[model samples]
Target: MASTSSGGTVELSGFFADLVRCETRLYNALNDRLRERHGIVTSQFEALRYLRDHPGSRVADLAAEFAIGIGATSKTIDRLEKQGWAARQPNPADRRSSLLALTDNGTQLVGAAEKTFTAEVAELIGGTLDSSSATAAAQALSKLRSVLERNQIGTPTG
Candidate 1:
Protein backbone atom coordinates (compact mmCIF):
# COMPACT_ATOMS: atom_id res chain seq x y z
CA MET A 1 0.00 0.00 0.00
CA ALA A 2 3.05 2.31 0.19
CA SER A 3 4.45 4.41 -2.65
CA THR A 4 7.82 3.39 -4.11
CA SER A 5 9.49 6.42 -2.53
CA SER A 6 8.20 5.49 0.90
CA GLY A 7 9.28 1.89 0.41
CA GLY A 8 12.82 2.98 -0.41
CA THR A 9 12.91 5.19 2.65
CA VAL A 10 11.88 2.34 4.86
CA GLU A 11 14.50 0.06 3.39
CA LEU A 12 17.25 2.63 3.82
CA SER A 13 16.20 3.26 7.39
CA GLY A 14 16.27 -0.43 8.10
CA PHE A 15 19.78 -0.67 6.72
CA PHE A 16 20.93 2.14 8.97
CA ALA A 17 19.33 0.53 11.97
CA ASP A 18 20.99 -2.79 11.17
CA LEU A 19 24.36 -1.13 10.85
CA VAL A 20 23.99 0.48 14.26
CA ARG A 21 22.97 -2.77 15.85
CA CYS A 22 25.88 -4.61 14.27
CA GLU A 23 28.31 -1.97 15.44
CA THR A 24 26.94 -2.08 18.95
CA ARG A 25 27.35 -5.82 19.14
CA LEU A 26 30.88 -5.71 17.77
CA TYR A 27 31.98 -2.99 20.16
CA ASN A 28 30.39 -4.67 23.14
CA ALA A 29 32.23 -7.88 22.39
CA LEU A 30 35.47 -6.03 21.88
CA ASN A 31 35.10 -4.21 25.19
CA ASP A 32 34.27 -7.38 27.04
CA ARG A 33 37.24 -9.25 25.64
CA LEU A 34 39.67 -6.43 26.35
CA ARG A 35 38.35 -6.00 29.87
CA GLU A 36 38.60 -9.68 30.67
CA ARG A 37 42.14 -10.05 29.34
CA HIS A 38 43.73 -6.77 30.40
CA GLY A 39 41.57 -5.41 33.22
CA ILE A 40 41.00 -2.34 31.11
CA VAL A 41 38.01 -1.29 29.05
CA THR A 42 38.22 -0.36 25.38
CA SER A 43 38.19 3.37 26.07
CA GLN A 44 40.96 3.15 28.64
CA PHE A 45 43.07 1.00 26.36
CA GLU A 46 42.51 3.50 23.55
CA ALA A 47 43.59 6.34 25.80
CA LEU A 48 46.74 4.49 26.81
CA ARG A 49 47.53 3.73 23.19
CA TYR A 50 46.88 7.31 22.24
CA LEU A 51 49.34 8.52 24.85
CA ARG A 52 51.90 6.06 23.62
CA ASP A 53 51.41 7.23 20.04
CA HIS A 54 51.21 10.91 20.91
CA PRO A 55 53.30 11.52 23.95
CA GLY A 56 52.94 14.89 25.64
CA SER A 57 49.35 15.24 24.46
CA ARG A 58 47.28 17.39 26.79
CA VAL A 59 44.13 16.30 28.56
CA ALA A 60 42.13 18.79 26.55
CA ASP A 61 43.54 17.33 23.36
CA LEU A 62 42.45 13.88 24.46
CA ALA A 63 39.04 15.15 25.43
CA ALA A 64 38.60 16.63 21.99
CA GLU A 65 39.91 13.57 20.23
CA PHE A 66 37.67 11.25 22.20
CA ALA A 67 34.69 13.60 22.02
CA ILE A 68 34.28 13.28 25.77
CA GLY A 69 33.80 15.85 28.50
CA ILE A 70 36.92 17.29 30.08
CA GLY A 71 35.87 15.90 33.45
CA ALA A 72 35.59 12.42 31.98
CA THR A 73 38.98 12.85 30.37
CA SER A 74 40.44 13.80 33.74
CA LYS A 75 38.93 10.70 35.30
CA THR A 76 40.39 8.51 32.55
CA ILE A 77 43.78 10.05 33.12
CA ASP A 78 43.41 9.51 36.83
CA ARG A 79 42.71 5.81 36.31
CA LEU A 80 45.75 5.46 34.06
CA GLU A 81 47.86 7.23 36.65
CA LYS A 82 46.53 5.02 39.42
CA GLN A 83 47.49 1.96 37.41
CA GLY A 84 51.00 3.37 36.88
CA TRP A 85 50.39 3.39 33.16
CA ALA A 86 50.61 7.11 32.56
CA ALA A 87 51.77 10.27 34.28
CA ARG A 88 51.41 13.97 33.87
CA GLN A 89 54.38 16.18 33.19
CA PRO A 90 54.87 19.92 33.20
CA ASN A 91 53.94 21.53 29.91
CA PRO A 92 56.47 24.15 28.96
CA ALA A 93 54.40 25.58 26.14
CA ASP A 94 51.23 26.01 28.20
CA ARG A 95 51.50 26.77 31.87
CA ARG A 96 47.80 26.13 32.29
CA SER A 97 47.82 22.53 31.09
CA SER A 98 49.89 19.42 31.76
CA LEU A 99 51.11 16.90 29.17
CA LEU A 100 50.38 13.18 29.20
CA ALA A 101 53.08 10.54 28.92
CA LEU A 102 53.03 6.79 29.06
CA THR A 103 55.03 4.80 31.53
CA ASP A 104 56.81 1.57 30.66
CA ASN A 105 53.88 -0.42 31.96
CA GLY A 106 51.53 1.58 29.83
CA THR A 107 53.65 1.01 26.78
CA GLN A 108 53.62 -2.72 27.42
CA LEU A 109 49.89 -2.76 27.93
CA VAL A 110 49.29 -0.83 24.74
CA GLY A 111 51.35 -3.27 22.77
CA ALA A 112 49.42 -6.20 24.14
CA ALA A 113 46.08 -4.48 23.66
CA GLU A 114 46.94 -3.63 20.10
CA LYS A 115 47.56 -7.27 19.32
CA THR A 116 44.42 -8.46 21.02
CA PHE A 117 42.25 -5.73 19.57
CA THR A 118 43.52 -6.34 16.08
CA ALA A 119 42.88 -10.04 16.35
CA GLU A 120 39.42 -9.54 17.73
CA VAL A 121 38.40 -7.09 15.08
CA ALA A 122 39.80 -9.26 12.35
CA GLU A 123 38.04 -12.29 13.72
CA LEU A 124 34.79 -10.41 13.86
CA ILE A 125 35.11 -9.28 10.29
CA GLY A 126 36.20 -12.65 9.02
CA GLY A 127 33.53 -14.42 10.96
CA THR A 128 30.76 -12.12 9.94
CA LEU A 129 31.36 -11.83 6.23
CA ASP A 130 33.20 -13.52 3.45
CA SER A 131 36.29 -11.88 2.02
CA SER A 132 34.58 -9.93 -0.72
CA SER A 133 31.62 -9.06 1.44
CA ALA A 134 33.90 -7.87 4.20
CA THR A 135 35.78 -5.70 1.78
CA ALA A 136 32.56 -4.23 0.45
CA ALA A 137 31.18 -3.66 3.93
CA ALA A 138 34.38 -2.01 5.09
CA GLN A 139 34.39 0.33 2.17
CA ALA A 140 30.73 1.23 2.64
CA LEU A 141 30.99 1.73 6.39
CA SER A 142 34.18 3.75 6.11
CA LYS A 143 32.61 6.07 3.60
CA LEU A 144 29.58 6.51 5.84
CA ARG A 145 31.74 7.24 8.88
CA SER A 146 33.76 9.80 6.98
CA VAL A 147 30.66 11.55 5.79
CA LEU A 148 29.15 11.56 9.26
CA GLU A 149 32.28 13.00 10.80
CA ARG A 150 32.59 15.60 8.10
CA ASN A 151 29.02 16.65 8.67
CA GLN A 152 29.59 16.67 12.43
CA ILE A 153 26.69 14.36 12.94
CA GLY A 154 26.61 13.07 16.51
CA THR A 155 29.99 14.70 17.07
CA PRO A 156 31.01 17.81 18.97
CA THR A 157 32.76 20.57 17.13
CA GLY A 158 35.88 22.12 18.58
Candidate 2:
Protein backbone atom coordinates (compact mmCIF):
# COMPACT_ATOMS: atom_id res chain seq x y z
CA MET A 1 0.00 0.00 0.00
CA ALA A 2 1.06 3.54 -0.75
CA SER A 3 0.84 6.24 1.88
CA THR A 4 0.74 9.94 1.27
CA SER A 5 3.05 12.17 3.24
CA SER A 6 2.13 15.76 3.11
CA GLY A 7 4.99 18.18 3.43
CA GLY A 8 2.99 19.78 6.22
CA THR A 9 -0.63 20.86 6.45
CA VAL A 10 -2.73 21.49 3.34
CA GLU A 11 -0.80 24.20 1.53
CA LEU A 12 2.63 22.67 0.87
CA SER A 13 1.55 19.22 -0.20
CA GLY A 14 -0.96 20.44 -2.74
CA PHE A 15 1.55 22.82 -4.31
CA PHE A 16 4.32 20.21 -4.38
CA ALA A 17 2.03 17.57 -5.82
CA ASP A 18 0.88 19.88 -8.57
CA LEU A 19 4.45 20.79 -9.37
CA VAL A 20 5.55 17.17 -9.62
CA ARG A 21 2.60 16.23 -11.80
CA CYS A 22 3.21 19.15 -14.10
CA GLU A 23 6.87 18.25 -14.33
CA THR A 24 6.14 14.70 -15.40
CA ARG A 25 3.54 15.76 -17.92
CA LEU A 26 5.75 18.41 -19.41
CA TYR A 27 8.72 16.05 -19.70
CA ASN A 28 6.67 13.39 -21.42
CA ALA A 29 4.95 15.81 -23.75
CA LEU A 30 8.09 17.60 -24.84
CA ASN A 31 10.22 14.48 -25.12
CA ASP A 32 7.66 12.44 -27.00
CA ARG A 33 6.69 15.23 -29.33
CA LEU A 34 10.27 16.12 -30.11
CA ARG A 35 11.24 12.54 -30.67
CA GLU A 36 8.31 11.81 -32.92
CA ARG A 37 8.75 14.91 -34.99
CA HIS A 38 12.51 15.19 -35.18
CA GLY A 39 13.76 11.69 -34.41
CA ILE A 40 15.73 13.12 -31.52
CA VAL A 41 15.12 12.37 -27.88
CA THR A 42 15.13 15.20 -25.40
CA SER A 43 18.42 14.02 -23.94
CA GLN A 44 20.04 13.89 -27.35
CA PHE A 45 18.61 17.26 -28.20
CA GLU A 46 20.07 18.72 -25.01
CA ALA A 47 23.47 17.21 -25.71
CA LEU A 48 23.42 18.52 -29.26
CA ARG A 49 22.22 21.90 -28.20
CA TYR A 50 25.00 22.14 -25.65
CA LEU A 51 27.59 21.06 -28.14
CA ARG A 52 26.22 23.45 -30.72
CA ASP A 53 26.61 26.32 -28.31
CA HIS A 54 29.83 25.27 -26.58
CA PRO A 55 31.56 23.55 -29.55
CA GLY A 56 34.21 21.65 -27.59
CA SER A 57 32.65 20.12 -24.52
CA ARG A 58 34.03 16.87 -23.19
CA VAL A 59 31.98 13.76 -22.50
CA ALA A 60 32.79 13.94 -18.79
CA ASP A 61 31.66 17.55 -18.59
CA LEU A 62 28.50 16.70 -20.47
CA ALA A 63 27.86 13.73 -18.21
CA ALA A 64 28.21 15.98 -15.22
CA GLU A 65 25.95 18.56 -16.78
CA PHE A 66 23.24 16.00 -17.45
CA ALA A 67 23.77 14.19 -14.11
CA ILE A 68 23.99 10.87 -15.95
CA GLY A 69 26.49 8.05 -15.86
CA ILE A 70 29.39 8.25 -18.31
CA GLY A 71 28.38 5.09 -20.15
CA ALA A 72 24.89 6.47 -20.79
CA THR A 73 26.32 9.77 -21.91
CA SER A 74 28.73 7.98 -24.21
CA LYS A 75 25.87 5.99 -25.71
CA THR A 76 24.01 9.18 -26.49
CA ILE A 77 27.11 10.52 -28.12
CA ASP A 78 27.52 7.32 -30.09
CA ARG A 79 23.97 7.52 -31.40
CA LEU A 80 24.42 11.15 -32.35
CA GLU A 81 27.68 10.33 -34.09
CA LYS A 82 26.13 7.43 -35.96
CA GLN A 83 23.43 9.76 -37.19
CA GLY A 84 26.07 12.23 -38.37
CA TRP A 85 24.75 14.83 -36.00
CA ALA A 86 27.90 15.09 -33.90
CA ALA A 87 31.52 14.08 -33.96
CA ARG A 88 34.30 13.56 -31.46
CA GLN A 89 37.87 14.68 -31.82
CA PRO A 90 40.87 14.01 -29.65
CA ASN A 91 41.41 16.65 -27.03
CA PRO A 92 44.64 18.58 -27.35
CA ALA A 93 45.00 18.72 -23.60
CA ASP A 94 44.00 15.18 -22.72
CA ARG A 95 44.25 12.01 -24.74
CA ARG A 96 41.88 10.11 -22.51
CA SER A 97 38.92 12.38 -23.09
CA SER A 98 37.66 13.59 -26.42
CA LEU A 99 35.85 16.80 -27.19
CA LEU A 100 32.37 16.57 -28.71
CA ALA A 101 30.96 19.06 -31.16
CA LEU A 102 27.89 19.31 -33.34
CA THR A 103 28.32 18.91 -37.05
CA ASP A 104 26.77 21.26 -39.58
CA ASN A 105 23.84 18.96 -40.03
CA GLY A 106 23.38 18.81 -36.32
CA THR A 107 23.39 22.57 -35.98
CA GLN A 108 20.85 22.95 -38.74
CA LEU A 109 18.62 20.30 -37.24
CA VAL A 110 18.82 21.82 -33.79
CA GLY A 111 18.04 25.27 -35.10
CA ALA A 112 14.93 24.08 -36.91
CA ALA A 113 13.76 21.85 -34.09
CA GLU A 114 14.34 24.52 -31.49
CA LYS A 115 12.31 27.00 -33.44
CA THR A 116 9.52 24.48 -33.75
CA PHE A 117 9.61 23.65 -30.06
CA THR A 118 9.67 27.30 -29.05
CA ALA A 119 6.81 28.16 -31.32
CA GLU A 120 4.79 25.26 -29.99
CA VAL A 121 5.33 26.33 -26.40
CA ALA A 122 4.61 29.92 -27.21
CA GLU A 123 1.40 28.95 -28.89
CA LEU A 124 0.40 26.89 -25.89
CA ILE A 125 0.68 29.76 -23.39
CA GLY A 126 0.98 32.92 -25.39
CA GLY A 127 -2.65 33.97 -25.08
CA THR A 128 -2.74 33.50 -21.34
CA LEU A 129 0.00 35.98 -20.46
CA ASP A 130 1.16 39.20 -21.98
CA SER A 131 4.79 39.74 -22.96
CA SER A 132 5.81 41.46 -19.75
CA SER A 133 4.11 38.89 -17.60
CA ALA A 134 5.69 36.10 -19.58
CA THR A 135 9.09 37.68 -19.15
CA ALA A 136 8.55 37.92 -15.43
CA ALA A 137 7.42 34.34 -15.26
CA ALA A 138 10.52 33.24 -17.08
CA GLN A 139 12.70 35.15 -14.68
CA ALA A 140 10.93 33.70 -11.71
CA LEU A 141 11.31 30.22 -13.09
CA SER A 142 15.02 30.84 -13.62
CA LYS A 143 15.40 31.90 -10.02
CA LEU A 144 13.47 28.86 -8.87
CA ARG A 145 15.79 26.67 -10.90
CA SER A 146 18.80 28.29 -9.30
CA VAL A 147 17.36 27.72 -5.87
CA LEU A 148 16.66 24.10 -6.56
CA GLU A 149 20.18 23.54 -7.85
CA ARG A 150 21.66 25.30 -4.84
CA ASN A 151 19.63 23.05 -2.58
CA GLN A 152 20.73 20.00 -4.56
CA ILE A 153 17.19 18.96 -5.19
CA GLY A 154 15.16 18.32 -8.38
CA THR A 155 18.33 18.12 -10.40
CA PRO A 156 18.17 17.49 -14.15
CA THR A 157 18.04 13.89 -15.33
CA GLY A 158 19.94 12.74 -18.34
TM-score (all chains, Cα) for each model: 0.82, 0.76
**Which pairs of residues collide in model 2?**
none
lDDT by residue for model 2 (8-112), tens: 344656766876896577667668878888988777778888898888999878877776778888999999999999999999999999999888999998997
**Top TM-score: which candidate number?**
1
* RMSD vs true structure, all candidates: 3.6, 5.1
Please name the candidate that would achieve the greatest lDDT relative to the true structure.
Answer: 1
Q: What total of clashing residue pairs does each candidate reach? A: 0, 0
lDDT of 1 by residue, 86-129 (tens): 99999999898999999999999989988999999989878778
